[model samples]
Target: MATTNNIDNKRYQGLIISIALFLSLIGALLAFTFYTSSLLERNTALIDQTNQVANSAQAVIKDLFDLESSYGEDISSPHIQRVLTRLEENTALITNSLSAIEQGGVITDNLGNRYQLPNISNDARLDVAEAKEQWNVLEPKIQTYLKDANNIMVSSADELAQAVDQAKTSSLFINESLDKLTRDVFSNAERQATTIRLIQVLGVAAIFAYFLIFVFFFVRRLRETDAEALAARRETQEIMQTVNTGLFLLDKDLKIGQQHSRALNKIVGEENLAGENFTNVLRGRISDKDLNTTKQFIEQLYNPRVKEKLVDSLNPLTKVLLHNTSGTGSDSRFLDFKFSRVYEDKDIARILVNVNDVSDAVYLEQRLEKERSQNDMQIEMLTTILNVKPKVIHEFISNTKAHIEKMNNILKNPGSSQYELEAKLKAIYRDMHSLKGDASALKLHSFTKIASDAEDKLSALQNQGALSGNDFLQLAVHLDDLLSLSNTIEMLGERINQTSAASTKAAHTTPTATAAGVRAAGAIDSTPQANSQVIGSLDFDEGEDIDLDDESDSHLLAYYQDFAQDIASRQGKEVQLNSATLEQVQIPERLKKTVKEISIQLVRNAIVHGIEPPTDRRSAGKPSTGNISLEMQSVGQDFIVSLQDDGQGIDYDSIRQKLVELGRFSLEEAEQLDRNQLLKQLFSSGFSTKDEADEDGGRGVGLDIIKTQVKESNGKLNVNSELGEMTRFVITLPKAS
Candidate 1:
């Protein structure tokens, strides 16, 4: 692997170097070409200027000849003046041109363009000097003749002849000198042209030679690189075929690279995965939310600033549950996808995805976890059963069985209409909540969790604006699980009971022990009747008949106390259950079960919601232990059951917030509701101020359960509270006839 990586690195470096060198060569060639072209332009411009100067010098000599010829034709002052004027103009033009040529100065052309000329070569300069000296000798004579012509035109004939002779002599020498200078200038320009041609040919030859050399080495290196790459590709293919992991590269666009491991096809359960959008590949296999998150995750991978290991925690693809699209493999699998950034220098290039089919390992882990959970539940159930009285466990088992049956019946009678379906959901929710309360009260966490999970499903169904029979399909599974759990608990309870009974029988098998055993069993049998007489003596309405006042009623009261304490402990609060008044009142037979269920739910509510924690209680200038008073008394033909807690009272503000959160009322509407109006929302189904539901009172169903039972018994329920002070619930049920 290291060797392959090194080779890859070397190839990348080589590619970079080659590109840089090619660009440099192009730049250098462009610069050299521009420089040579500029030099040629300057040379051409100099040659043109030199030709213009030479033409001006020749014009000077022709003007002199014309002056001399003019004197020969006419000795008139006007003709002489015309000749002199022509001669003077030509002379000035030649002097300026020669001076400019010799001394590197500006020379104006016919079109008024001024060009700065450089000094000519030594040979050309010498020729220019000689021409200037010859012109000087003729210049003074011409000036003298022009002055003499202005004074006396006819007497100047002799002087004009002399001037013509002087002009002829000067013109010969000057022309000779001018010819030499022109030749020298032309020669220099020709030499420069030759040098330019030579330089261009040499430069082009050098460039071509360099290009050939560059191509030779470049091709050689390229062939070697191709060979190395081919070897690496074969090695990579071997590894790809042999390795179990699914490997591929994902570009910034989230497209898979063309080269991918053979295992990727099997792991993703697809062929031709290359060049496909990664999101599309995972589209139907995973959830839309995970797919979107995966896109964002890969995007983050492309960002060089985000550290690979740091963002790894946010990877949504880890341990993804993918349903196989192909019909060949298992119906589903668990694939673990790991991503790492592929870097080019300091920049992120692509993401390397490593996929492993972790189905077997995951399935094994899940099986172990399931077994471990079962073992834990068994241990917890045993601990609970051993700690609790046999009668209590029996009562729990019976209640759970009945609740499960009620749920099953509700499912079986899933109504066709939306309202009826919603009603069915509520009914199941109430039963599940009741079951959860019972399980929690008995510390049967496994059953509580099952019940909670069922409630969660029901809650989801309930939240839907529309309902269908298909929505209830999932509920059947929860019901089945609950029923199975109840059976298991019942069997375990029976086994424990048999074991206890056998132990007792064994302990009392001796002859003397036999008589004591008989007496003990009789006392156990008559204990309910004995307690009934004791309850019958309590002050009550005249015709109030107490139910089977088994020690079960006392156990029921004790259960309430213990249940309150357990809930308080779980919520990190201190609570004292005051049921002295409740103990004295004889609950009528018909209302006994209804009253018990209502009391359990209400007690749980008070502990979970109304009651303040120990710290809050102390801060409220109250005792650390919160007070929960339960009282039942006969009033006229009715029995009034009052449960009050000296803790944080019903928070109307919290209720208003919950109302807004649940979308039952807008924020403005919730704020506008009075205390009396808010109280009505408290009894509404699926309404609670709590953010999240737990096994305890957060589901908001507890108060609804209370209201439901009260309505069923044709009882009146009232609630009153002072915020931060106390909250009370009053239930008034007519005495059973």
Candidate 2:
């Protein structure tokens, strides 16, 4: 403030000085003008006096010659007297004018206006004194001539001639002196005029120099101020460039300021962002919704009534996903934008925007979240494995491993054409769907979720316009996850079996109980082939030779019963499995896996699709518990496995509606199809009556699996359904050699 005051004081002082100088210049100009006017007046007067004196001297010479000529003319003539009188008057005028020229006195013109004439220069005075002396000498002769001519007209001619000669010589000398005096006076006036002009020129140059000096100082001060401002701006630019965060100013119009941080370019993957509209900058980078919200948020910042902190949570740009298209390719980034109001005094002027690239941080956070979810899933899986029966878990793990292996093989040879790729996808989808169903039955939710996710991927691939090898690349990642999960479950299953074995050995109980415990443990530890061998040991190949009371056969029936009950409980239905017929007849070792696979799929399909919920059953005046019967028989060289469920039978109308809904067939075409054709449609891959797929039967892959299994086994499948009565599937396979 003191410095400012000092500068102000200096400015005031300069202004005062300038004013004084200007006034002095005006005064000097006035004085010079007055002086020049006075000099011109005096010079005019002197030249007028000089010209009058020269005119008077010439008149005297002419009058003197006229007097002598009058003497030669008639002496008695009146012209002679008139000439003498005019000569006396002219002589008197020349004497008075020369006297005025020689000294400072008033002179009169022909108009009788008197003017004061200053004393002449030395040269003019000398000429004036010589002219006066000649006039003094000539005046007496002129007077004598006038007296003589008036007295005697016929007097001595010689005397008259002598007087004339004296008058002529005197007159000639006086006129010569008067002419020299006139030249001298005019020369002096010219010299004085030149000197005055020189002075005026010098005064003008001095004023111009002063003005130039004032301008130089004023401009210098301005340059200093500009330098300070420029230095400050340079410093600001350096800070802006050095900062990592994108920084800029936004006005109320949503336009960016002229100056912005250099990092703004790098963060936004753009250049020359200055002066661009803020919305245009963020337009393509963010969603339209976020961009509009950001605009409003910034406008709010410019409002003083809106507390900046209160609206901070409403910032839509916080962790915004921006797709930057300014680079060679589109790059996605997560950016955080913060706005602060720039206040000038009490009013908000601009909004300061700070943008930061939070992609890495957000990505890291997402990865951490994923890891936590995966850990929770693993824990849930471990808990599930512990609660499940060892035999069931063992069988589930083996079947899952087989399905995953098949999927991996399918992925390995994705084929070249679109048709071939789609076929591979459907094959993998069937395997994944089957795996999902089994996992859902065992309550291994982690496995079921993975399988379901994989099925979704395959379904997407199947729906695409065309398929390529690259299209299946993402599926490989999902397969790896499934493979990893299966391995973890297998490890958990082995550990549980070992722990159970240890607990059984430590109990030291009865031999029978111990053997049962050993058998259960052995089943879990057994490989897929080993488990099949154990089933083959039952030897229930032919209907007459089977033992109904065999413990292994009972375990097989119990397995199916438990599986059916678990699926019913999940679907909110009540089911009672009657495997009495199945106990009487069993399949060969070669058909054990096929029969198990077929039975599991058929049982889930019945509980999920065929069985009505308990409330519905009660409302229909039927028992709340739905009945499912399993039976196996051998006819000649073929063994038949059958599964029947007594619930709401197959709804062919629902199948037809689903066909029309899926765009597979028009309504007229579907209505014209018979029951067998509808069933054939139901068995097709990717066909489902269910609107949405869950962990269970909605995938439509269950029946496809049964169809594939029967085909591979070189068997026949028969389906029978009585609406609202029952639905049954019979599978016939040639008896193993």
Output the number of the TM-score-best candidate: 1
> Model 2 over residues 334-424: C-alpha lDDT tens digits?
8899988876657787888899999999999999999988888778777766555454566677788888788888888748987798788
List of clashing residue pairs for candidate 1 = none
Task: In model 1, state the lDDT of residue 264.
Answer: 90
* Per-residue alpha-carbon lDDT of candidate 1 for residues 562-640, written as tens digits (9 for 90 to 100): 8998998878988889877655566776776678788888899889888887877888889999889988777888988
TM-score of each: 0.75, 0.53
Q: What are the C-alpha RMSDs, in order, of all predicted structures?
A: 8.0, 16.4
The models' CA-based lDDT, in order, is 0.78, 0.78
Runs of candidate 2 exceeding 4 Å displacement: 1-244, 249-255, 259-271, 277-333, 338-353, 412-422, 493-589, 611-648, 722-726, 730-737
Error (Å) of candidate 2 at residue 336 is 3.0
